[model samples]
Every structure is written in structure tokens, then in C-alpha cells.
Target: LNFQLLRVMEEWQQQLGEQHYVAMANDLLMNLDLPGQVSSLTDIGPELLVQLFEAICCDCRVGMIRPAVTQADLRHNLACVIDSLANDVLHVSLSHIRPADLMSGNYEAIRNLLEIFHGLMEFLVGRSAGGDGGDVTAETQLEENENLNGRLTDQLDRIAGQAAEINELAKRLAELRQADRPLPQTPLPATAAAAAVDAEAAPNGDTSDEGIVQ
Candidate 1:
């Protein structure tokens, strides 16, 4: 198990970059009294196993290793890690592997545990990175949608105001046209028309009579 863990650490260092790996190792060493090298799987203790599990499963920094993995993939890989250790090394069925059982000072128990941890670390890294990116993207898209909706609402208001003004102008123009139209003339009575004709001819008839008398 120590040999497997060493290999896993070496591969992780290569993937994570030497500088970053060194920094992470320094931090882990500060918290725990772990040796610089692993002599045997029997030398590993429960504390180290717990620390390793926390580092790989719960630490945020592990995400830097892979950034594109999805949640489903992470879950699947974690399940496989547990199943592999349970079936091959422990020869038992396990829904989840406890840190205590990982390094109980027993060679068989510790065997392949670190290997499973290594695999689980890869998936954890992907999950962390992908979750952060997904959150940021979702927030950005939401903000953009809000901005677009605001713009659409403003345009609709402007169009509505313009339409209202057009309607009012049409109404006023109709009123003005109605005011300019000629009033209808009523027809005179037949008796009134005859009286008006005689009045107009009376002066002409009197002048003719005066001419004849002279």
C-alpha cells in the first residue's frame, strides 16, 4: 500500500506540477508527523489514512488536477475505487471504505487502499474544479438574461408610448377635420320660395309701368 501510495503521489506531483505539489506536501507535513518516505504498508497508521482521505476527498486544492469532470463521473469513479478495494484486497463487500479500516496496521487491510485513494483523488479533483466553473457560468448566464429582459421591457414601453401618441394625434386630426367641414343648408318651404321670387320682380314691374305712362 505504501508503494502504491508513493506511486500515486509521484503521479499526482507530475500532474499537479512540482511547485504546487511541494507546497501541498509541506502543508500536509505541517499538520501531521508523517515520514518523508514510506518503508512499508504496516508502518502506516490510522491518522495518516484519515489525513490522506481528507486531503483527497474533502480538500479544495485537489481540484487543480482536473477541471472538466462532471458530478456523475466523479460518483462513478468513487464507487469503483471502493468496490475494487473491497472485492480484491479485503475479499468482502463494502458500500463505503472507512479510513480506520484502510490502515489498521494489517497488511491485507492496507493493501490496495492507497491505490483506491489515488483513483478517488483524481475524481475529487475533477468534481471540485467542475463545480466551481459550473456555478460561475450559471451566475453569468442569469445576469445576462436579466439584462436582456430589462432591455426588452424598455423597448416595449417606448413602443407603447409612441403608439399612444399616434392614436391621440389621429383623434385630434379627426376633430379638426370635422370642424372644417361645411354645415348642411336646409331647404326653404315652397310658399317662402314663391314670396321671395315676387319680391324680387316687384321693382322691375313698377319701373316698366312708369316708362309706359311717360
Candidate 2:
């Protein structure tokens, strides 16, 4: 079953999770880029959010150089480490804001965010090309990731507000029904369940229906 592969996947997913949550937190932080202290994780801006999401999805390759880990495992682990460091960037951004004047893509904020990802990936390419680790700089060039369409918190807020309002309306409906109803004298079949629940029910009730609304 390639348990190691599975573990590697699990680790990668966790790295994604950490990066996912943390980067969103950064976007929510000192939104305007503070000077030296970490901005709130929630203050990270739109552009940073997109870049972080791209870093999460992008595949990173790291070479096997007599390490205890295999190429795939090492790649997965290194990808995870890169993600972890990206979160570290967000963590640092909470308190430290790189100045636009000094921000030339070589600073620690940039390093903390991107260096390891490109460096290790390139290191893999070099080893493949010539069988040795190549010189990789502590600086990396970050291309802005274009896929993260909207801020995570904004999405969450919209979903949550819709859910709350919908659920509240459902509650009001249920109260109205109760006031008008006589308890069914005969226990109805499971088929008689309230509309929403029945439509969404599995034996375990794990349905993707409007329950999120109700």
C-alpha cells in the first residue's frame, strides 16, 4: 500500500493545511505591510494569499543524495518543509513588515517565504542533470501565483453569513409548523421525515444537502 507514500501524502496535506490556515491568517494581519513586527495572520493581503496558495499546490522536487529518504519521500518532505517555512513567513509577517523601499525580493520576508521552495526544487534539477547538488542561492524569485481568486476569510464569512441566515429562517419555519401541528398519532415511515433532512439523509446522515443552511 506504499505506507510511506501515504505518510508522505499525509505530511504534505498537513503542510497544505498549515500553509492554508496560516497564509489566510497573514492576509488578515497588518494588511498594509508593517515594518518589522508580524502583522496579524488575518492581515495578509490579496496578492500574498494567491502566492501562498500557489506555493501549496506547486509540486516541488528534491533529489536523493544518500539520504534515509527516497526521492519521492524527500520531495514530499521537502515540499512540506517549504510549506512550513511559508507559514513561518506569514508568522513573521505578523510582526515584521518589509518596507516597499527595501523590498527587492532578497529580504528575509521573501527568504522566509520562498527561498527553500525554489532552491530545493532547483537542487533536484541540478542533481538530475549532473549528479551533484548545485549552488542555490538563499534568495528565490517569486512569481505571483494567479489562482487564488479570493481571500479565504472573505469566502468563509460569506458562507457563514448565508448559513446563519438560512438556518435562522428554518428555525422560524419549524416553530411555525409546531404551533400548527397535531403530533402524528401514527408514527410515520422514515419517508415522512422533514423535507430537508430526508433529502439529505444517508443512513449515517452524511449528506451534502442544504443542511448547511438549516
Candidate 3:
């Protein structure tokens, strides 16, 4: 299966140009964290097979390959890859793969599935290179651009929402600070008892002792 996958990739390199092939390969290996030099797909371990398939599925989903590739097609191809890896390479049971009952162990089935995958790859690469009577039409390119624009618009909307939330939080914080400020202190009026004492001491508008008995 690895050999087959490698052959498909090499064909892609030849047909799609080294730059395009390298870009696809790098995308697959982006976060795999594989050790040493991985000069080919065969260098990838059985455990990482799912990741490789997932990357390819993503490419298909995003219209990176051919617009004709549908979700069902991706699903089928993915099942094929998983089936081949689980049964042949890893020698594991189908339960290990999601939708365990997807495919049963059979040499014939495996071969057929691999051939299908190869054909699918060929179709993808051929379409990308404007061959196989399936050149990327203007409509497909427009659809891809619209999809990309939609993603960018969603991101921008999310960013704008976050920015608005931050601004609102900042405004609330400033209002809280204003509300927490200490108010200026005001002098209190004199007590009633103190006022009475002053009035008594100044009786008849005089503070002198002229009316006091000797």
C-alpha cells in the first residue's frame, strides 16, 4: 500500500510539477512531528496513516484537488485507505478503525480499493494539471474563491465581535473606576447643644458680665 501510495505521489510530481507536489507533501507533513528525513510516503508509520488520509481528505474537501470530488467520494476513498492500512499493513481488526464494519478483510477487496484510490489520485492530479478532460473550469475556481472569501469573512466577523466585547469590557471597567472614586468631604453643621451654649453665653447680645450679681 505504501509503495502504491508512493507511486501515485511520484506520478503526481511528474504531472503536477515538483513545486505543486512539494506543497501538497509539506501540507501533509505539517504537524506530523515525524523524526529524521521523510523522503517518501513510505517513511510514514502505520499509526500515522490516518493523518495522511485526513490531510488528503481535507484537500479534497476544500476543492484543492478537483471540484468534482464530492463528500461521498472523499468518504469512500478514506474508507479505502483506512481499510488497506488496517487490514494489510497494521494487521489490525476493523474495530480499530472508525465505522469498524465499513470494510471486511479480503485480499481482492484491498486490491480493488487501492486501485480505486490510485485512480482517484490520478483524477485529482490530472484535473489540477488541466488534463484528463477535466480542466479546472472558471466556475470551479470562482467557487473555490467564494469558499475562501467566506472563511475570511467569518474570521473577520469573529474578530470584530471579540474587539467589540473587549471595548465593552473596557468601558465597564472605566465606569467601575469612576464609581469607586471617593467623594469630597463636607464640613458638618454644629450640634444643637453647642449652638444653645453659644446663645446662652451671648445673652442680650452681649458676652460681658455687666448683669452678674456681686
Candidate 4:
């Protein structure tokens, strides 16, 4: 499913080129679901949400390139998408599943969010390194860099925090599942339970079904 989206993005990049693709992506981001429900996504299933996240990441990366989008616009969209996935999706959906039934795909959503943000951060770093700060005064460039850095740091923190939360939740779930599990069955009492208990407890206890000593 992820492969298909990547292929589509690659084909689009080939057909539209980076600049136009980025523009289209920015527009798409503006319209895509922002306050989407993680619960709702689960109802339909994770595959759709996974694809949506991947598509957003791919487009946002293209849009962040030179001559496509302003840093402000890119950052705003990134924030919205990340917030939606984190608050509306990962955190919310984690509450719904049983620990014994933890799905790998749920964690995949977190990975997808991290992947997108990391890619964007890398693009930002590359852009900064390559003098995308040009045409601005030194003070302005410094402030812009600071703002971008802050946004990236806040997002990385959010993603990292979410990852930790998921880990803890998984552990807790395992504990709960283990605790809730039924104990191994014991042999049933023969005749009266009190007599069975006495027979089992005697010094020469031999309550075998084949030879129950009186």
C-alpha cells in the first residue's frame, strides 16, 4: 500500500516536475481531512489512514522545495497533519485495542508520522545548509532558522513522546492480558469435594482415578 503511494508520487513528480507537484500538494493538504477520527479510521481499517499519511508526507516533502511553498505555509500544514495523527489517531486509537490483540499496523501509523516529519526536517536542514536563507537580512535569516528549528524540535518531541507512550501501553497491555488469562485446570474432586481434599491431603495421598484408596 505504501509502495503504491510512492509509485504514484514518483509518477506525479515525473509528470508535473517538483515545483508544480509541490504546489498541487500544498493545495491538497489544505483540503484533506484535518480533524479526522482515529476511531473512524479504525472502523474502515488502518490501510486507508496509512495511505493518507504517506500521501501527505510525500506531497509535503515536494512542496517544501524551493519555488513551491513558503516555509510558513509548509510548517502550518505539517503541524496540522502531525497534530491530527498524534492526537486524533495514534493516541486515540491506542485506547481501543486489547493488549493481546495489538496490531503492528497501529504502530506503523506512528512510524509513518515520524517518517514524514523526519523527511521534512531533513529537507529543512538541507535547505538551510544550501542557503535557502538567501535574500534575507542576517537578523531575519537567524530568526527564521530559529523558528524553523523550534517547530522541528517541538514535532520531534511529540513524535518521540508518542513512541514512548505506545511502548508503555504495549507493556501494560501485556501485563493486563497475562493477568486476565485463565489458570491451568486442576483435576476435579471425586465424590464429595471435602473427601477429595482429605484424600489428596493424606500422608499416603494417592487419588489416582484408576485406584482411589478408601
Candidate 1 residues 126-204, lDDT tens each?
4456565544577765664455445434534543464465455556555645666432242675556776666666775
**Model 1 residue 176 CA deviation in Å:** 99
Predicted candidate 4 versus true structure: per-residue lDDT over 111-132, tens digit per residue: 3343443444454455568785
TM-scores of the models, in the given order? 0.27, 0.20, 0.25, 0.31
Error of 3 at 178 (Å): 3.8
Q: Which of 1 and 4 is ahead in TM-score?
A: 4
Please tell me which model should have the higher TM-score, number 2 or number 3.
3
Candidate 1 yields a Cα-based lDDT of: 0.45
lDDT of 2 at 20: 48
Off by over 4 Å in 3: 1-134, 182-214
Q: Rate the local accuracy (lDDT) of all candidates.
A: 0.45, 0.38, 0.43, 0.44
Better of 1 and 3 by TM-score: 1
Instruction: Show the lowest summed lDDT stretch of 10 residues, model 2.
Output: 141-150
**TM-score between candidate 2 and the true structure:** 0.20
Q: Deviation in angstroms for 115 in model 2?
A: 30
Error of 3 at 15 (Å): 47
lDDT by residue for model 2 (1-214), tens: 2334444554553354345445434432333232333333334332443244334434433232233344344334434444443353222222222223113332224323333223333333443575345554433212111111123223334434644654555565556466765444536534345654656564575555543334
- Model 1 compared with the native: what TM-score? 0.27
Q: Sorted by lDDT, highest first, which candidate order results?
A: 1, 4, 3, 2
Candidate order, TM-score descending: 4, 1, 3, 2
Candidate 3, residues 43-72: lDDT per residue as tens digits?
333323334554434433322223325545
Best by TM-score: 4
